[model samples]
Target chain A: MKPGTDWKNSYRANVFEEIPCGIVVIDRNLRIVDQNLAFTNIFGDGRGQTCYEVTRGRHTPCAECLAEQTFRDGQRRSREAMGVDPAGKPVHHLVQITPIRDETGNVPFVAALTTDLSATKRLQREYQTLFEKVPCYVTVVNRDYRVVKANTLFRKVFGEPTGEHCYQLFKRRHERCPECPAEQTFLDGGSHTSSHVGITRDGTAAHYVVSTAPLVQTDGETTHVIEMALDVTRLHRLEAELLRANALREALVENSPYAILILDQRRRVVLANRAAEKLWDCDRSTLIGHTLPRRAIACRLDEIVGRNGGPAPLVDSTIVTAKGVEIPVRLSGFTLHPVEGERSTAIIAQDLREIRTLEREKLDAERLAAVGQTVAGLAHGIKNILTGLEGGMYVTSGGLARHDEARVKQGWEMLERNIGRVSALVKNLLAFSRGDEPKPRLVRPAAIVADVVSLFKELAEQHDLVLETEISDVAPASMDAEGIHTCLTNLISNAFDACLVSHKPMCRVLVTLREENEEIIFEVTDTGCGMDYEVKQKAFTSFFTTKGSGGTGLGLLLTRKIVQQHGGSVTFESSSNEGTTFRLRFPRRRLPPPVEEEHNGS
Target chain B: MSREPSLHAPRVAIIDDEEDVLTFVRIALEDAGFTVEALDRPTEALATLEAFRPHVILLDLLMPEQMGVSLYTELRASPVLRDVPVIIVSGLNARDTLQEASAATGAGPPAGYLEKPVDAAALLDAVRRALSHSGRGTP
Candidate 1:
């Protein structure tokens, strides 16, 4: 071999065999002249063969061949082609063919450069599948707002939105959106997000959150906007429903008749109903989130705490009003444990003043009825006795007319006795009828008993009877002290009179004061000539006196009437010649105030 | 010719269940120079009214068995005694019953109704007024 020729061949072999891309040199007849190792590896080593046969395994020249085009036009040409290799695998190639001349101005050869695009084509197919199958709607639009490409969901949502203005398909508007995110993305080449309500081609409305990004080409030019829209109509509906429910609950609580107050774990007032506002006589807005005032009416805060802390059992208390009026109330509190954090207490307050007033009225009416009945019966009996006295007087007057000294003196004496009897009866009646009104005051039961014992001491001594008292130091009770004094005096007098009739003539009257269930009890017990069944039955009945000539029989009846007015009751136990015990019990609960004015003009 | 002198005084009968009231009225009528016959028993006094033929009859209300209103009703039912003027004296608080009874009775309800306990002068005046109205001479 010649030295220059050897060097030229060695350089050609090294250059042709080592190139990374597939290279082929075709002659003017469109035959393969030279090829690299990569080209043979890709096209299966066909030597001196037609270019179409070597690359495509076809016997004839390839249709629309770049080399042929380049040879004819003497200009570089490039085209995309699909070819088959020796293994029957399909390959995509981008081929560039250029004419080469040997300084003679005549085209001698075509150098064809082929770039395999199979990997790039496969990637594009995968991207198309992802775009078609994604759940969210995806679309591509040009800068002019015209849809360039759309996925299946995008087409289904906007009905083949391609080639149409993106705003027309997504917003069903004739014009572009004023602040479209896609337009912003195209301008800035950045991603943007927006939420808006859109109408579909079928006129169905939907809420959507759309994200848009600029699609930048390899030349760094943003030619399209890629948008992804997510539907959020259901979430919007849920938020609306929650708001409605909250409004309804607020309305119900505000209008409730019961005084309702909601307090946080820290005992601060969080919410209060209109009733609570009215009850406290404070503005509702001012009460919210404020610590409960110490001077809450109806009951002291400490007393309520003593009853039970929230959630408290139903309890009764007296609440003081802003005006310092104490009112009876029932307070109940319960804890509300919501799904979220801290527990709160809901307190309900019910006013009890009206019910208490009604109870008092009923008791007053019953006492009036019982007293009226007794008065009527007493008046009837007194009238009968008066008639007897008058009858005796008539006989005495007739006797006096006979002019016998003995008869005259006897008649005078008899008239004197009957007159005295009638006078005593009138006195007793007057005493009972007077002082029906109660003058209530705080008094100790023991003190009243002591006073009665002292007042009756002389009478007891004269009658040879023993009168003693046992007093308790329990809390004082409110009552009509004068009325109770009268009651005790009458009982002691009766006991002294009874002792005079007993065999031993020994009278023992015991007055005791005790406390039971927070009630003040006064017991008057006597051991002297106890009454029989018949007398006991008529003991409290007016004008049924057992003391033949002296007794007026209004004492026990009046005693019971006064005791009943003080929210108390009187009961007795008696046995023939053994003993008689009268007990009066007064409750510690305060009496209700008078409902009606004491005096009426009518 | 000398007329036979009247031997007995004309009698005025007073009926009441109350003895003190009866004695008081008897004294007043006697002092007024009229014979007074007071009876405690309504039934007995009614018999005396039939026998004695009192110029005026005073009736007390609210008596046992026969009330003043009922007694007045019985008297008016009799043709002979119905014309005799009757007065109702009552101690009851209700004057309506007395007025109603007087209006219902045909005999003009005792020339004057008196309430107990009747004063002496008032009782005398009532008796005189009743007798004078009946055209009867005082005893």
Candidate 2:
């Protein structure tokens, strides 16, 4: 043999074991294959083993064995096969087999070579599983809007894809969705997201949020787009419902009749309603996001939050409008639901100024009617006095014409008595009708009663009436001292007159002054001819008089007016032919607060 | 004798709650040559209506227990006193009271309407006209 020819034989014998490929030699009996080092590393120790058993971990030769065909035809071929390594891990291999020739040009041995492809196969499987198993719907669309790949989730919800168009599968249409984000991505080579509404294979509506990203080729040419979508129909419906509820709440707050305010926990106004605007005389733009200007509103808000989650009760206060008109209001506060993740407070206020004005009008109407009735009563008394005057003058002139001394004296006395009555009537009328506000001050009841009784004692003596006083000393109370004195005097004199007209064996009048139940009571009781039911009904009413022309019927009226001016009251209890008592009560704490005149343009 | 009838004394009945008004009217009527009877209580005046047999009645509108309108109703309802001439004497404006009384009584104005604080001459004149209008006496 030639020397160069012998080198090929030497190279095979020495270099076959280091070839990196798993090289094995098998005879026609498929036994005793020699494998290189790389084969041993992957399959482990294949010397003297059957070729089928060593390469494929099989008991016999494979049914379509490449080595058998190579041996018959002396051809080389490659294919893939799977087996397990010694460690029981799966191994995928690409096997190529060739024939080795004998000296007569006959093949005696076949060579089988294998490359391990297990890692590449594992990556492919992993990708497939990921595509099918993810929770969101995923798909791949070609430039023609065809669904080239669809995940299991997409298939489950929409239907198994059959090379149909993306628009046809998702929207049951031949055309694409308007302003398709996928189309925009293709044009710009950028990613885009959009919300889409479509119908499923089941003909049910579906809402989805889809994102498209460019899938580029090696030359940076975009041929297809990959889409990832989420089925957001349920989430979208819930959002819509929440928006509707928010709108309803806004409408209710805006239209409420009561002045409504929504404040943050920090007491800043977050919302003010129309009524609140009108009540404060400010618009919503000025009111919101600002602390209320009025102290009354601030105080009420503090009361509510300061209590820590409880509602505030109604409170009466005066609020000044933006126009600086002072108006009365009744306000209440309550905890409102969290607004925009913030703790909030709600306030409701009634514009009591309208109610106050209405009440004042009603009182004015009643007072006017009372004045009208009083004028009528005064006229009746005056008319009766006029008749007395005319009679007295006539009798006096007649007595003078007759020149009778005793008759002249009698007529003159009548004239004098009538004149005195007219003066007293005028004084009582003035006191009753006067609108001067009583200036309240502290006074002692016992001392005032003693002083009043002393002045009337002489008159009582002349009338042959007994005036007795039972006064108990007490602490000074708040009242108008002059008005109380006047009321007491009028009552005492009335009682004296009552005693004189009673025709009882003993004409007695009792006066008492004391304090009980936080009230100072001045009582004047008389044993006199008491009144009947009709007199009782019309007692304090106007134009009613039991004393005929001798009384103007205004003395008791004036007494009552004075008592009321002192934040007190006058009441009488009378029984016919038995007695009558008038009680004047002055409550200490009942004095009205001093009126402060409100000014505008502040 | 066909002489002036004003010389004869006529009976006058005055009912009023005001003692001063009753006293004044009684004296004036007596001085004007008329016999007078005064009652303060309207309820008592009802009892004396037949016994007193007055030629002219002076009725006051406002009184305790009964109003002047109610009293007039009572008098008109009575057969014995229905024919007597009534003169409404009121402290209220005489014309207004007469209008109201006339409407309530379903009659024309009374024989005479006298508003109080009246001049002495007006009193005698009203009574005289009331008496003559009743065909009971001449003034």
Candidate 3:
């Protein structure tokens, strides 16, 4: 059984039909081609049919048929074509056709080879989708930093970037970045990351975290660099805000006007502001952490806390600074409650010096206004009296020239009476001008009222005016006793004088003292020929006289001034021909602390 | 038979709202050897001035109804009394008001200005100066 020539040829044909690539043999007429198993599997049973009908399912030769051209030109040709498989699914095939002749120098048939390209086609589609849909901007650049390929986001963010340098689109610069991550990745062949501030295509500045990786070729050479940029503009803004807030807090604490001092739970100064340093007349470093002296800081926190009869929080208390100057301060504090094992208090001391100064100024202004009103009223009264005197003098002089003795005597008496009136006016004016400057000494108000009544009793008896005293046993008020005595005497004496012209010719003077609220009140009530509206209007005015030639009008003015100096007020209620009652109220309080002067009396 | 003095007596008019002031001025002027006519009321002063045709007039500044300045203005406006001289006797701060009134009344404020509480000698001197300056009588 020696192998015949047909048997060897048949065996080689079987091997060729089983090859992975599809094979077909077509005649010169472009008719049915001899097809291999792979070809029959791809294009389906092609014997006794045209090549176009078998591969393209077309009844005629396909457009731009290279196999027909190859038979005519006796040349070999290759092309990519679309074909359908037995399952009716589309396939892309790489096809090659070569003309074969049987040693006759003529083309008899063409053998075509096709390769399935569906796997490579699907892989390219997947790569395109990933490039387009990734969150970050992605770009591939050549060694020169020029853009080679960019995804849809990269093209949309920095439009049509191919053929332009990546630095130009990302950094908006003509030159590359000084420390470009892409260049570093190319040089190192490893991933490089950096934070960069860049300007976008829309001319907005943004911060980006850019990572670059080298794209290595088969020959171990870095051909391109891939860059991914993540925008971090909002994070940078947050960091800036935090830094600015910290600086503002420090500045506010340093420049606050109030003397602010922080004390630890042990009552030691921990922190002091600029105002505290100046108020204490010591450097901040020296005062901080020092145990506050009890005498210098007069306010005892224990006292206020005990008064509340509970576990007291930080309370408002007076504190004298290191300079030996007393200051009113609001001391508010709270325990650091939640901090475990931390037995500390946060205390803030706000100085009340400015408020005290404002109050002093207001009191001074009120005093001056009262004095001015009194003076104006006095001037008006004096002007009327002077006009009367001028009239009398003119009439008297004329009468003397005419030798009228009766007229002369009347003028002389008028002159004498008016001179006495003027003298009394001068004396009262002097008294009012020199108001009682309070020489405060602790004394019982009831005793003063009793003494005043006793002194005036004889005078009241002589004037047919009864004097009575009703004194209350109250707490002693600090005041000038002599001022109180003088005021009571003047009031009682006026009551006696008022009764002189009344038809009834009877008068009553009552002096009483009592304590109400935190104040002591001394009241003087009189029943006599009470004042009319006009007289009452000018009651406290200097030089206003209801007794014609007897009244000097400075009594009540002086009394009021004296009462006010003792931290008290003088007020009255009166009705025409009814009676008059004067009440002097003295608050049970001491004079406010003197304002801190930049320098003591110079 | 007695012979009367041939020398003419100077006639003076004193106008003031106060009767005592008018009487005092009359006495002072008469003692200085001048015939005087005193009018206490401002309205009556103008009538008395016309009748007496005085060589000098003493006028008080402030009065009811018609003040010294207004009376002076009215007197200067009349043709019959335009030549009469008026001396404003006032207790007011009168330096500025007198000057202003002098400009308003063409006859001028007075030959001399006198304040209140005027002495007899000063009053006599002003009358004499006014009469001599007006050429109405020899001082």
Query: Which structure among the candidates has the greatest TM-score?
Result: 2
Worst 10 residues of 2 chain A by lDDT: A297-306
Docking class of 1: incorrect
The DockQ assigned to candidate 1 is: 0.04
Model 1 per-residue lDDT tens digits across residues A415-457: 6755786787778678777756777776776788888889888
List model 2 lDDT by residue over A311-394, tens digit each. 577877767777887777887787867546877878888888779899999999998988788788778777777777777787
Candidate 3 docking classification: incorrect
* Pairs of residues clashing in candidate 3: A32-A49
Chain B TM, every candidate:
0.81, 0.82, 0.84
The 10-residue segment of model 3 chain B with minimum total lDDT is B1-10
lDDT per residue (tens digit) for residues B1-139 in model 3: 1123234777778776555455456645654567778775565577668877877778876553346677777777766678877776765445677678768666555666776657667777787777778876643
Q: Which candidate leads the pack in DockQ?
A: 2
Quick one: ranking by TM-score, best first?
A: 2, 3, 1
What DockQ would you assign to candidate 3?
A: 0.05
TM-score-best of 1 and 3: 3
* DockQ of the candidate models in sequence: 0.04, 0.38, 0.05
